[model samples]
Target: MYSFKSRIRYSEVNERKTLDLSSVINYFQDCSTFHSEDTGNGIDYLTSQNRVWLLNSWQIIVYRYPVLFETIKVSTNPYSFKSMFGYRNFMIQDENDAVCVVADSKWIYLNSDTLRPVRVAESDIASYGLGEKIPMDYKQGNIILPEQRVSKEPFPVVPANIDTNHHVNNGQYIKMAENYLPDQFSIRQMRAEYRSAATLGDVIYPEVALTDTSCTVCLASENKKPYAIIEFIS
Candidate 1:
C-alpha cells in the first residue's frame, strides 16, 4: 500500500467546513496516481505507450468527513488485476489512526487512441503487486436505476469537468449528482458507474430519483443514454 499524510485544506472542504465527498475521491485518485508515478509507470510513460486507466466504477463509504485543518492520512492499494480490469482499495485515517473513510474502485486499462479496453502488461502488474483486499461489502459496477425519476434541465460539459483524458473526471460526475440531492442529506456512501465518456460540448441531461434512504442521478446524453450513474446513500 502507498500512503500520503496531509492536513485537510480549506479549499477541500464544503460549506460545513469538512472535507467534501468529491475531495475524498480526488485524494484516493491522486494516491493511486502517485503510486504509479513512483513505480515508473506514471503519466509520461503511459502517454508514451498510448495507454491509460479509465475509472469504471467507485464505491466509497464514509464514516465521517474530516474538518478543515485536520491532519489525515490517505492510502491506497491495488488488490487485484484481471485482463483489462483492476481492483483497488483506499482509506482515509485521522491523526489518531481511526479510519474515516474507505473505498473500493474498479478501473479498466485502455488504449488511449482507441479508448477501448486493453490487457495490462505483465510489467505493469508487477509494478504494483497485489495487496490484500480491504474489508468492504463490494458491489458490482452496475447501478440499478430507480423506477421513477425526474429530468433536470440540460447542461453543457464545462472545461472544469474535463480531465487529462479529455473526458469528464470521475469525481466530477459525483459532484454533478450531488446537485440534485436533498437539502442537508448526509451521504454515508456513494457509488458511481461510468457508462461512457462525456467530453467538451456534450450536453448532459440529468435525471434524478429519490427515496427515503437514497438518491440516484443519471447523467445522460440528450437522447437519454447515460454517461454515468451515481447513487448516494444517506
Candidate 2:
C-alpha cells in the first residue's frame, strides 16, 4: 500500500466546511496516480509504451466527511490483476487513525493507440505486486439504472473537462452527476460505471433518476448511449 498525509484544504470542502464527496473521489484518484508514478509505471511510461489504464468503475463509501484543515492520511493498494483488469482499494483516515472514506476501483489496461484491452505485462505486475483485498461489501458489475428517468439539457465537453488522457477525467463525471442530486442529500455511498470516453467538443445529455434513498445519473451521447452511469446512495 502507498500512503501519504495531507490536510483538508478550504477549496476541497463544501459550504458546510467539510470535505465533499467529489473531492474525496479526487483524493483516491490522486493516490492511485501517485502509486503508479512511485512504482515507475506512470503516465510517461504508459505513454512511451502506447498503453493506458482506463477506469472501469468505482465504489466509494464515506463514513464521515472531514472538516476543513483536518489532518488525514490517504492510501491506495493494488489488490488484484486479472488479464486486462486491475483492482485497487483506497482509503482516507483521520488523524486519529479512523477510516473516514474507502473506495474500490476497477481498471482496464489497454493499448492506447488501438483503445482495446490488452494483457498486463509481467513487468507491470512485478513493480506493483498485488496486496490483500480490502474488506467491504463489494458490489460487482454495473450500477442498475431505473427504467424511468428525465433528460436534462445537453452540454458540450470543454477543454477543462479533458485530462492528460485527452478525455473527460474520471472524477469530473462524478462532479457532473452531483449537480443533478437533490439538495441536502448526504451521500454515504457512490458508484460509477464508465462505458466510453467523451472527448472535447462532444455533447453530453444527462438523464437522471431519483428515489427517496438514491439518485442515478447517466451521462450519455446524443444517441442516448451512456458515457458513464453514476449512482449515489444516501
Candidate 3:
C-alpha cells in the first residue's frame, strides 16, 4: 500500500470544524495519484502517451470525521485490474491508528486522443500487488431515484468547477449533492456513480429523494439524463 501523512487543514473543515466529505474524498484521490506517480505511471507520464485515468465510481464509509488540525494517514492500493477497469481501496486513519474512513473505487483507462476506454497494461501496475480487497461490508451498487422528487434550481458550471480534464471534478459532484441534504443529517457513507461528464457552461439539475436514514441525489442535464448519482447514509 502507498501511504502518506497529513494534517486536516482549516480550509478542509466544515462549519463544525470537522473534516468535510469532499475533503475526505480528496485525500483518497491524492493518495491514489501519488501511488500512481511513485509507480512510474503517473499523470504526466500517461498524458505524454495520450492516456489518462478517469474515476468511474466510489463507495466511501466514514466511521468518524477528524477535527480540523488532526493528523491522519491516508493510504491506497490497486487490488485488481481487468480490461479497461482498475479497482482500488483507500483508508484514512487518525493519529491513534484508528481507521476513520474506508473506500473502494473503480477507474477506467482512457486514450486521450480519442477520448475512449482502453485496456490497462498489466505491467504498468503489477508492482502494486493485487487481489486483496478492503475489509468493509459496504459495496458499490446502483443508486435508483424515485420518479417524483424535489428538484432544485439548476446550478451553472462555473470556471472553478472545471479541472485539468476540462470537466467538473468528481469531488465537486459530491459537494453539490451535499448542499441539498437536510441540515439535521450527518453523512456516514456515500456512494457515487459517474454516468457522464459535465463541462463548463453546462448547467446541472439536482434532484433529491430523502429517507429516514439515507438520501439519494441525482445531478442531471436539462433532458433529465443523469451525470452523477450520489447516495448519502446518515
Candidate 4:
C-alpha cells in the first residue's frame, strides 16, 4: 500500500470546515504518485518516455468527514489489471483511525504522443510487486451504481472548461457538484464515471437531483445522452 500525510488547510475545506471533494482528489493523487514511485515507474519516468496514464473512472465511499487540519493517512494498492487498464483501491483514514474515505479507480496506460492506449507487459507489472493479479470478481460500489437520472438545456462550453487535450477538465465537474450542495452540509463521499468526452462545440447541461441523502448529477448531451455521471453521499 502507498500512503501520504494531509494538512487540512482552510483552502482545502468547504465552508463547513471539512475536507471537500476537491481535497479528496488531492489526497488520492498524492497516494497514486507514491504508488507509482514505489513501483519503480513514476509519472516523471513514464512521461519522460512519452507514456501517460489517463483516468477512466472512480468510486468513493465515505465513512466520516475530517475537520480542518486533521491529519490523514491516504493509502492505495493495485487490485487488478486488464490489457491497457487496471484498478487501484484506496483508503483515507483520520487520526482516530476511522476510515474517512474508501475509493477504487480505473486507469488506462497510453502513448502520450498518440493518446492511444497501450498494454504493459508482464515484466512491467511484476516490477510493482503488487502481488496477486486482481481477480475479475471483486465487488465494489453500490448495486446498479446510481444511474444519471435527469438533464436540461445545454450551456456554453467555455475555454476554461477545456483542457490540454481539448476535453473538459474533470475537476470542474466537481465544482459543479459543489454548487448544488448547501454550503452548510458536507460531502461525505462521492463516485463518478467519466464516459464520453466533451469537446469545444459541445454544449453542457448538468442535471442534479437528490435521492434520500445522496445527490446525483449528470452532464447531459445536447441530444439528451449522458456525458458523465456524478453522485454525492452525505
Q: Cα RMSDs of all predictions?
A: 0.9, 0.7, 1.2, 3.8
Q: Is candidate 3 or candidate 4 better by TM-score?
A: 3
Residue-wise lDDT of candidate 1 within 1-234, one digit each (tens)?
899999999999999999999999989989999999999989999999999999999999999999999999999999989999999999999999999999998999999998888987788778788899888778863789987999999999999999999999999999998999999999999999999999999999999999999999999998899999999999
Report residue 36 deviation for candidate 2 (angstroms).
0.8
Candidate topping TM-score: 2
Per-candidate TM-score against the hidden true structure: 0.98, 0.98, 0.96, 0.79
- Per residue, candidate 2 scores C-alpha lDDT tens digits across 1-234 of 899999999999999999998899888888988989999999999999999999999999989999999999999999989899999999999999998998999999999999999998788779987889878788876788889999999999999999999999999999999999999999999999999999999999999999999999999999999999999999
TM-score, cand. 4 vs. native: 0.79
Give the 10-residue window scoring lowest on summed lDDT in candidate 3: 138-147
| Model 4 poorest ten-residue lDDT run | 131-140
- Which pairs of residues collide in model 4? 80-134
Could you tell me how far off, in angstroms, the CA of residue 212 lies in candidate 3 after the best superposition?
1.4
In model 4, the runs with Cα more than 4 Å from the true position are 37-40, 131-153, 156-167, 182-186, 199-202
Per-residue lDDT tens digits of candidate 3, residues 86-201?
A: 99999999988999999999998899889899998867677667757879986735777767679889989999988888889999999899998888799998999999999999
